[model samples]
Each structure stands twice: as C-alpha cells, then as structure tokens.
Target: MAIIKLSAIERRRLSAFITCLVVAILAWVFTALSNPYKFTVKQIISFKNAPQKRAFHPLQSDTVNTIVQGSGWQMLFSRMNDDKKVIEVDLHTLENRNYVVLSSQLKQINFKKQINNEIIAVNPDTLFFDFSSRRVKKVPVKLITLLKYQKQFAQSAPVSIKPAFVTISGPAEILSKIDSWETDSVVLNGLNESYNARVKLRPSTEGNLEVLPKSVMVNIPVDEFTEKTLEIPVKLINNHNYYDVKIFPQKVKVTFTTSLTKYPDTNEDVFEAVADLDKWKLGGYSVLPVKLTHIPSYSKIVKVEPRNIDFIVKK
Candidate 1:
C-alpha cells in the first residue's frame, strides 16, 4: 500500500473542484423540477348540487385517481404533503340521467378552485348511481355533551337548543330508520357559569342523506350550589293491617345541596321522608328504614339524620 500526501496548494485546488461539482449538480436538479410535468394522485370524491326530485346512492367508490398537469415542483411537493385533495361532482344532471361524466364537468369544478394546476384526467371518468324515492322529514336535534364542573357547581336548569327540530331529506327507506340527529360533542372543563354557543351537527354517514341547517345554537345554565337542611315529618306506608305504629322520631333532619338560585324558595314541602313498614313485614327486619320518597330535581341529598327509625306497633 502506498500513502500519497499532497501539498497545501494541491489540497486547496481539490476542495475548489469538489465545491464546483456540487453547485453544478444542484442547478441541474432545480432546472428539472421547474419544468412542466404530468402526474396522477388519489383524491376523495364528493358531490354537490344534488337533484331535489331524485334520491340517489352512489354505486362507485368515493375515491378516484386524478391526473394533473403541473410543474415538476408540484409533483415533488405533493408527494411529500400529507393533506388529501378532494374533487366534487355536480349531481344536477342526475335529474334526467343516471350517470355523470367527470371529464365534462372539470371546467365547472376547476372554476371554483381558481387555480392554474389543470386536472388532466380522472381514472373513473364516469360516476354511476342507484335511484330511490325521495322523502322529507323533521327530527329532533339531540345535544351531546361531555362537561366538567367546578366544585359545588352544577346545572341549574334544563339545557336549551334553538330550533329543536331539524329537517332532513333523503331516501325514504333511510329516513325511516333515523329518528333523531345528534350534534357534535360539546366538551367543556371546569364549567362554573352559564354557557351559550353555536355547535355543528354530526354529518350523516349516508352519502344520499341531507341535513338542513347543519348547525344549531346551544345554551346550558350553570349555578353555584349551597347546602340546605330541613326537618321533614316521617310518614308510615304499607300498613295494610291497620296497625297503630308510633315511630320514636316523628321528624328527621334532611340535609341536601341545592342551586343558589332556588335556595331561597326551597322548603321542606318539596321533600317527603317516609318509613316503609313493609320493610319489617316483608323482610322481617328489626328496624324500619327511612327513605326520601320525593326530592326536588337538581338537588343532591347529602345526609339523612336518622336513616333507620325505631317504632312500636300495636294491633
């Protein structure tokens, strides 16, 4: 083996030659990418301008291969990009015909994009459909929520949604299976006050179904909760044999949490504590259990002073 060492001047010359070679390669690459080229990419197909008189379902796939004529740079960048392109087909022709030609409507579709990247062709040049009777129906809009509230705070009133009902139109058979449409999930954390906003509804999975007024307004009422204690008289029930029953404690302390807005107006009249005599007769229990038969909505029962009562029965 022979080791060849070069002088300082020779080393500098070699470095310059390598630098020039790299620059020349980069320039050629850039020029090639700048030239026009044609390529094909997969795109999702959507529809617009649906025929009002006809209900149709597509017989083909929702995706198609789109051939585009553009700069080589576009092809190189498009391959690296993760975003998908969508092509929309007009269905107005379906009123008189059963199929649509994608090539014929490229001009109309491209007009909406207002771009110079021309679409050369589509793999599935034609789209077919299955027809059915169209039906219109009105269904309730259900609000979906995933909410978290601050400590001692809760919903004080029923949640409200404007235009509770939405109109849906689609194939008669499909519409018959749907009773209600649900909105996108409403998510909130540490909710402590009233919330009001507009939410979009979940889109239909069926391509032939259409939902009107795609969004709805929502209102949720929230309030702070406070504790309340009331002395409610215990009533005896299920004493079918006319037994004279005397419970040691005639009244029990009911401690509960209610919204601040209803605190002032809330009273023991809204609560009913009863001792079921059937508990002893049916289960042969030694002690009678006291239960709250009636409690206001949106109120939480914290503690009942005497959950079990001692009674004397005489026949």
Candidate 2:
C-alpha cells in the first residue's frame, strides 16, 4: 500500500476517538469485575389472598449474599432497581402446595417489598363447619304423679315411664346436651286414709325443650282403717247324736282391725268359731281353744292376740 499521510486536525480527531474507545473498554472491564447481578433462594412461609395485587415479604430480614451472572450493563441496570424481577405467588397455590422454593437472579431484594397487606376478607369471622357423620340421639322420658286412697292413706301409683324415650338433634358439638334426663319424684307419705290427688309432670331441668306425653294419670293403692267387734257362735264338731254335749260359752268375742275400704259392706257371718270334742266324753269341761275362733270378714289376719278361749261342755 502507498504511504498515506493525514492532516493535523485529522490526527487529533483520530487520537480523540481512540481515547474514548479505550475509556469505554476500561469502564466495561471494571463493571465485569464488580458483581452486578444476584441469585437468591428463599423459603415460602405463608400466603394470603389479596383484593389487589401486592408484593411478598420474605422470611428473613437480613441481606443475603447471592451470585449473579450477566453482562456488565445488564447487571448494573438490575442493581439500580432490584424490585422488578421479584416472583409473584398466589394464595391458593400456596395453600394447596403447602410449600414452595423460589430461586431467582436479581440485583438486590428486600423482604418488605415481597409482602403486602392488601388482603380481602372473603371469609366470615365465624365459620359454620359441618360434619358428615352428625347424627340424632333419643332421650328418655320421665313421669311424675300423686296418688290418694281411702281416708288416712296415700301412696304413689305404680308410676311407669311411658315411651321412656326422647329424641334430640343438633350439631355434633351440641349433641352432648342429651346426656341425661329425669322426672320428679312423687311424695305421698302424708296422705291419710283415702284421697284423690293430682300430679304434675315437669322437666327436672328447665330448658327450651318439651317432653312427649307430658301428663299421666295415676291410681294409688291405699287402705282405710276400720274397727269391728264380732261375736262368733261356737259349733261342736264330732258329737254323737246320743251324747248331748253343750258348750259353756255359747258365743265368743272377737275384735279385728282392717282397712275400711276393703272391709266396707262385709258381713259378720263370714266368721265362725268351732270347738273340737273328738277326745272328750259326754261331760262338763272347760277348755280354751288353741286356734283362732273366727276369721275376719274380707280382711287379712294381721295379728290375733288371744286365739283361743275357755270352753265348758255339759252332757
């Protein structure tokens, strides 16, 4: 090539352009030496639904050292503003997956920019939770009544807990209310003779509920006291027709106590007094019967103080 020479101004212009290129190259080298990009891995703790899009907060608050690889200019641009490349996460995904690992290369990151409080209150404060196996339980029934009989006596009727069953329904949490139920006890110790009384059926524990067949009729068994004195006629047994045997006492006095309700309208003829002469000859004798001489009419023998009496026979 032929030798070509340039003017002074051209030479100075060329020198200036070379100087600028060298400065640019040195600047590029310097940027490459300095770290401008960063890569980080963080743990996702929890997530919340937001009405509006917002950033996330990291679990750690301290700055973490991370390695980033990029062009000098690109790395420098990232360092200027570290927030643009942060990953966005959804609440549903977090809740479903339960855990997530976020790996990213950035200039710098902040934990505060990753989190925001723009959450919406889609769920109510009180939730109505339902259980699939919820079931109904039956409660028992109780009965209460009063009973009266003839004057001077009172008692409780054979009270029967009818249908003895109850039913209750509610949430599983509330079903425990049916553990126990009871009826009131009847008091009839003070009644005299016979009486007719009324009874009330009420819940042992007052509550906002009802019992089936709330009322019942009761028939109390009772007795009345009645005093009676009866004269029993004595009859001789096993006496031969030829031998005329006579009882010294023609009549025997007997007294008895019984319930008037049971003894009402009973006749005195129901009682009898008898004498045994199987071992005696035709003669006059006095003997007391060892057994009861009479049976009370329509009444049970509670006691007999003197069962026998002296008997004298004459032939």
The lDDT leader among the candidates is 1
lDDT at 209 for candidate 1?
92
Q: Tens-digit lDDT track for model 1 on 1-315?
A: 999899999999999999999999999999999899989889888888989889998998889998888888888988998897888888889999999999999897777652757787998999999999999999999999999999988999898999899999989888998999999999999999999999999998777899988999999999999999999999999999999999978999999999999999999899998989999899998889899989999899999988998998998
Best by TM-score: 1
Candidate 2 lDDT, 190-213, residue by residue in tens? 556433344345642311133444
User: Which regions of candidate 2 are displaced past 4 Å?
Assistant: 1-188, 193-220, 238-243, 261-264, 278-286, 297-315
lDDT of 1 at 123: 86
Could you estimate the TM-score for every candidate? 0.93, 0.29
Candidate 1 vs. truth: CA RMSD? Answer: 2.0
**lDDT of model number 2:** 0.46
- Model 2 Cα shift for residue 111 (angstroms): 47
